[model samples]
Target: MKKLSSKIWSLIILFLVITVVFMSLFTNFLYDQLYVKDSEESMIEVGERLQSNYQGGKVTDEFVEKVEDFNMYSTFNVFAVRNPKELSACVPFEIDYDTLIGPEERRQLLKGEPITKIGYEERFEREVISVIVPLTDQNRLEGIIYLYYPLARITELANNEVIILISSVVVFSMLLAFFVHKGLGHIMRPLNELQHAVEKMSDGDYKTRVNVSSKDEIGKLSEAFNEMAAAIQSEDEDKKTFLATVSHELRTPISYVKGYSEAIQNNFIEGKEKDDAIQLIHREANRMERLTNELLQLAHSNRDQEKIDVYPMVISETIRESVDLLKNQSKHKEVEINLELDDSLIVQANEEKLKQIFINVIENSIRYSNKKSLIYILLKASGGNAVIEINDQGIGIPKDDLPYITEPFYRVNKARSRADGGSGLGLSIVKDLVKQHNGKLLIDSELGKGTYVTITIPLMEEL
Candidate 1:
């Protein structure tokens, strides 16, 4: 179970959204404040103009005409002059002026104090700001001049500002999201490759690698991963060499013991016969002990490595050596070993492991081949790989067992394998060694015909 790394752009996008939201709110607040101040100033100026034009005279049609002209130029609606005993109104039509002006503000205007107030006027069903000014003639209080101005225009402007601010914020957010997604992808691309490499390693693909050239943290991580894989690969190669050496050493002693044991049992010498038999037995016991130890070492070498070593070697040499090693087993059976090889057939591989691969193939052939049967070794270079095929005229393996031949400890005929002294590890070892060389091992067999094992290794030049 693995988890994907968190993306950096997600955090950046969140921060951008918060900042944009805060800035939009602040801008709207400032705009509303400025608009309110301008509206108030316009209302005050209109009220002063009316008071200046008509303050010295009594109410007349001429003064009403002046108020109407001022109303056309300004936002003022309700204009009235209220004296101590009577009220002279120039509202252009009949209306309740008292209701439009709140009582407290009206009282302040009548007391010679100019007042401005904002309230909803019921007659118009709208909100308005009113400005009131006092008029005086010859040192006596003549009347109060009141002006009403609707706040709808300011409200509409503020609404438009909010719409524009919201639209800007949305646009900015979308652009930020796009850029953030792209930047995060750029940063995480190497990490994604590293992750895939790790998965391949888990599945025993040790040669998996990541190529990321950068001076950043992700690049550093890729470098570290490659170093670790190389170290593991080196250790693995050392282990394989150690196992091959040990296996080779044990084989000589095993052959000697088997040879002497048969010689003594057949009485090649007459005197001290029992002693010779005991000595032969001792040698055989010791040989088996050494062989078992080598097998264990080979098994330990098969553990997972972070990387693998791949090189080129002659396939013909490997097959020839394997056939010569097993030639003794073919003595009584009259098995004919043949080679069909390309002169320059070379493959990328571990040489010793490649030798072991053919040893396993030929040994299996010797064990199962019918008396006087032929075992053919064929080699070809094709499609960037050197293909080595071992064909044996033997008691062919069962179809069901063919698929599991490469699995450790699996055998088609367990009783036969035991009788043949096989530990059921040959094909498994062959498969592992071939994979380490970045190659494939294929087995094809029919019940009555014969079995063919094909080892396909990458060509040296291709590597």
Candidate 2:
């Protein structure tokens, strides 16, 4: 395969070479016609000048000498005609005026048409451009004036000019090719770096960066690529951290469950001791179950959202149910409950998933709320949405943690969470469930104040 630079250069050079050849041929064709036309016009001018010199269709020897001198100074092959019968020459040429100037031209000249033509003479081995006029004496047609220009000189002049034009084109093309090559190199520099970056990323090295130097499209692309790499690196680091946390979380409980079960099976305890062992195994198993459930929820959230069954359901009733379920738990925390709901807060949602969303959020609030502090559950139809907010007066989530509070396995206070048996998937689950119902989740909090997790689900049209 050809290298990119080689391919580009070859294509450019090919186009330029073709252009050069085309221009040469085209200029060749056009220059001849242009030269012939110009020659005819010059000849007309000379013929008019000679008309002033002629006297009654008769030219003196001096006038003839002057005509010959005029021919020598200029670039014309000259001849004179005294009517149709008499002809004279100022220079040597094979074809006479009678044969060279056609009767058709003669008729046209008699009728006041300009005599001009382009012809080739076999004897002279050259093409000719000619112009003839009626010699006038006091406005009376006396004789004829004929002037011819040989094309050999015009061809020489055209050849010289064509060479100059082609030379200039070659120089310009070379410069253009140089500038284009430099420009492409500048553009491709970023792409080349990007290739390496992508390759490194594929090899699991995500810390790749590209240098951006221009404000052009290629530079913008480089910027975007860098951003993508940074995001991937962050996600990869987060994944590793998550795995380590899960490993520690899983191993501790599994070891407890295994050790306790084995101890009981071996009859290592009796009476209260045996009961305690069984309870310990049961608690460890429950911990494992919670962890497993969280993992499963995280894994299947996207698929569950895809298969969500949306129907109009009263959000206020769902909130009441969730509040009731958490009633005993909040009471243990000595947390007072306050509910404000609009009964008409109906939203398009999957009932089971909606219930689960409410359960997770309320449970999170219950776990975090300060003892004897108020937990506010508000549900109202606001702007065509069922707006549900769970506010807890507790150790609020830090401001810095608010953005990532809903990410799976993200915990603001890991120690407190572990002590409370919190799986860290509650808000994450709430977020995904809300999304399944085409809803938005927003968590607002300031450290030491309180946290408010608001869910907005599209309200069903009350028909």
Candidate 3:
């Protein structure tokens, strides 16, 4: 349930904290291994060097005086003593002889072996590192040489460096967090806007949009979101327009049928007038039937694109067949359809749908053509496509209406009687069928000149 930015910031802070802790631990390890160990070894060497000065003789004042004089100038506390109790006067705390030279340590000291000690010494009130070397003469315990240094002085060498390193790391971490926070803010701004826009869209505001500020992935995502919003808004508007137009088209016919049926049932008209009323009702019923059928076909074409079965066939065959089927109607209109086709031009398409495309376009041309005019149909191969052009020498469509000619129920001449012009869904059906065939449909027309329809479908590859 946590937000993305919060999770990211948490991870960043965790990483920095872990990094600083690990570095601090590693620095302490290095200080112990490199500095403290080296100081211990140096103390042992100094004690051994002082032990070599003892010759085969009894303990003497001259040797002790020489050790005290060396200790005055050196960092180590050098001691040459005959007994452990004599060294007790060097510090304030009372010293126990057994604790200073334990049984095991006494044995090693008598054997002329060096002993190193490190830890807290109550006598010194701090941690101390000391090395003891026995001054043995002729295998007899004579005296002992001692060299000790405060452990704090050895550690003090690197404390300042370590402190500075940790301080710098803390400061750097703060700065990194600051910049990362700002960067995340910049990056998530577009995403936040997109989230709000999506919420608005879910609540029926399809027109909501987000701004695109950069060419990065986030910017591209914003652009895609805006495009999707625009498409949804357009689809919503189209649905509303479609519903309103459908209601208007059906209302008139329903009113006529209702009024006429009621009049007849009530015996308001008789004889020829009754027959005429029945005929008018029949005509309205037929118009309504045609509109419903066209609407169903349009919906099927949109949904059935993936279901259409396609095969290779000669493009000219479908055109010629469509022209032949429409011959009787063209004859009634006094319009002639002429064909100029390349018989070898083949395309991959559904045969029935291709024929439907041709029939719809050809019938449309015939319906709009001037009497006794010629409709030219041409088929040819161009750019690996089978291109078909249907041009009519009819009352052409206005330039402004050309763009919307393929919209269902759209008519170039809105005031024209539906019975004379036929339903305006023919070209819309043609367009969908052409698209189902993976073809492009282009219509160009000039008012009073003519309308030209071009359809291009991919040609089948020769095996």
In terms of lDDT, which candidate is strongest? Answer: 3
Please write out the lDDT profile of model 1 over residues 1-463, one tens digit for every residue. Answer: 3334353545665787798799778766765577656777777777776777774756666775677666666655745554522333443223445654467755665565677767776656666666767675655556666676666653465577788987897898788778867877777789889989999888867777899689788888999999888877777776776566556555655776777777777878566865776676686576567457546635754774325565667778877887888888878679999899886977666677778778878888878889899999899988988888889999998888888887655668865754465656677777777777778889999887789988888887742
| Superposed Cα deviation of residue 157, candidate 3 (Å) | 7.0
- Evaluated against the true structure, the overall lDDT of model 3 is 0.86
Report model 1's TM-score to 2 decimal places: 0.48
Give the candidates in order of TM-score, highest first.
Answer: 3, 2, 1
- TM-score per candidate, chains pooled: 0.48, 0.70, 0.84
Write down the lDDT that model 2 would get: 0.78
Instruction: Name the runs in model 3 displaced over 4 angstroms.
Output: 56-59, 83-86, 89-113, 123-125, 137-142, 153-189, 214-217, 304-307, 421-423
In terms of TM-score, the best-performing candidate is: 3
Clashing pairs in 3: none
lDDT of 2 by residue, 62-150 (tens): 66567667767777766665554554434344546666557786666666456776777675688777777776555555566667766
Model 1, residue 150: C-alpha shift (Å): 14
lDDT of 3 at 18: 96
Alpha-carbon runs more than 4 Å astray in model 1:
1-130, 134-306, 332-334
Model 1 scores worst on lDDT over the 10 consecutive residues at 84-93
Candidate 3 similarity to native, TM-score? 0.84
